[model samples]
Target: MAEQEHVEESRKDVLIVACGGSGRRVFAESEDILEAPVVFINSNDSSTIPLVPSGMEGCHGDPELASAIAFENVGAIREAFQGYKAVVVFSIFGGGTGTGMVPVILRCARDCGCKTISVIGIPLSFESARRKLAQGALGKVSEASDRMYVLDEDSVVRMCPDARVNSTFRMISHSIIFTVKCIADLLSGPFFSTFFDKVYTFAYVSEMNPVKAVEKAITASGDDPAGGIVVAVSSDLGEAESGAIYDKVAEMTGMVPDIVRRNDREDTKMVVFFSVWGA
Candidate 1:
């Protein structure tokens, strides 16, 4: 156990890769908050038109042959991933680039000795065709990824019923960003702990009252929540409010959660990320 922990600690480099148009847009918007190296994979120059920050990188491929290219250039992709402890991939399913490249990237990351986690956004049920494609991609992702989080678009719609199209996408982006940040905090923050053997499930709630956020997070974790839950709260709330959030998480999970707080936001709204491990 000590040797395994030492191995994990030694490979601390983390790389976040975003694929497809929606994924790239999310990466571009949330890059400031991510505070890590980012690689954006796209199928064409049009998708790369957006202004990317200095430290970020981009990989472009032909739309019709992106998956093929990924498979053929496995060596190059693995090289890019070398020395990283883990690679977290953010992609929206149903799209050509993201759906096709996700599995390939997962395989490449593993080959490079990096543990892989995929954060995928599934299409809403209303979009039947897209949902079908997403379902197909899910199988490949399951086989390749060491761990996976499927963020249902229907959940985003339910959370923001009155939100416009752009607002809905923004909410999805917030979920992805918060989830990634929470995991990073556990792995490298000042309050680091070895409780995260594997993240079995996760939930995200944004712009909600602290109590309601905890309730929603628990509900999102499903009916039976038995695990060491890690709750990370990002808000500008006071110490008392933060305490309330922590207490709620502990009460709901029936376990003393590993809690982390961030007060950098100017908004009154809070973003809560919950990651549950164990059976």
Candidate 2:
């Protein structure tokens, strides 16, 4: 195994880790949109991201072998996660490295006393064997991380049937990035600390009326908010639009919503976040 000369410590409050082939590709494609530091781990020696210093070669889609390799590098992995307030793991869970490494990586983050979130993508239904493998891995990954967001590849493709294959995956990557950004913003606020264990969900709406955006976001979340809600609107949104959105959410959920105004955005995009009791 080849080793990196030194592991540079992360300076950001939040750290993002991309695991496996799909994970690495997503990060490479969307890194420009992300503000936090990102680390990559994979079995491929040719990968641009530094490989873990274990002698083992690629897992060849065997999750057990991937798990063993990750366990071997626990000390190094833990070191990477240290000093960050939160760690977000990104992976596509059908293959070997992601299915195996993600759970271990999340555990390392938790051990380092960092809040853990995982954004995982499952394979399409036609890939029956890979889908089965992903399903098996989900339980372990969910238990290991504090917050889990699952993206169904089949559903995503179905939603945009006309999109080219690569474009569809790019859309999925954007969704993951959006989730990460929203979580990072929410984590900085006082509200997140109060509901750390709640079932948090998110939705983003662009090119829609502010009030309608809120409605669509809530409806898309598929979870009824029993507690707090956070609505983040683009900078260009008017005070009137913001106020109307707030009233709409409050009327719908009977909970006063927290509004976060973004100064960086020029377009009329809104991201809605809320928490509910976990089942």
Candidate 3:
């Protein structure tokens, strides 16, 4: 593999690793996966997001296609990252197919010499027996990931004080998708694939941090609150969104972090931006 001599722009070469929420198995086996050009994995219809083409059984396109998607299968994640400028992982909660896939995908990115980060959405403990498998999923990435952003649905909703489970999911999912949309928007920009996007960075909340914000958010939610705007601003955050950003981060952590400033020295950006929900 050819090695990069230096770091360049912000949103250029890219690798996106997305896991299927519920219908992964279905899409995995559905001929649509092989048939469609690309399919965004999901358990259900997510309002009005752009369609990534459903992978069917007999669909045929370019044999040498630039992109390849495998629903939630980890075995093929590395393949998808091949030649990618940067890798962004988006998975709904942990466990099952996605759980096993996170580590392998992270390892693959590093092995391939590409900048990588894992963006994971952890489900609430009270969600259901199947929904709360984040422990295992988060454990692996937390150790190996350069950047890990964890969003706790249970903690985020409690901030409102009146949001229910359904409402919480909607709000959380929307926020997640919204953040993702920002990324996708970056990808859509002309300067993205050209001037920038080769480097990698991460941002997310951590297991050990301030206890105030997490406590307040959780107490209000009536459940365990350990969530906040967990993020690791990869590129230069203009130097303006610093203090206020930290203040908001303090709101989530309940206390200020020891280190939350800009560091753009490394060509390979690796940050773990987290959002704590409970104290």
Model 2, span 1-279: residue lDDT tens: 111111122226788898998877778766556666788888766333445554546789988888887888788888887789889888888889999988988998999999888877877788899998897888788788777766656655644568897887777777667766655555554535544543554555564678877886776555577557777766567788878987898788888887876434645567666664552
Candidate 3 stretches with Cα past 4 Å from truth are 1-9, 22-76, 181-279
What TM-score, over all chains together, does every model reach? Answer: 0.72, 0.76, 0.50
Which is the better candidate, 1 or 2, if ranked by lDDT?
Answer: 2
Please write out the lDDT profile of model 1 over residues 191-254, one tens digit for every residue.
3243353334456776447778767766654445655665566545667876776788777767
| Rank ordering of all candidates by TM-score, starting from the highest | 2, 1, 3
Instruction: Show the colliding residue pairs in model 1.
Output: none
| All candidates: CA RMSD (Å) | 6.9, 6.6, 11.9
Q: lDDT at 275 for candidate 3?
A: 35
Worst ten in a row by lDDT for model 2: 1-10
Best by lDDT: 2
Q: Give the TM-score of candidate 1.
A: 0.72
Compute the lDDT of residue 277 as modeled in candidate 1: 44
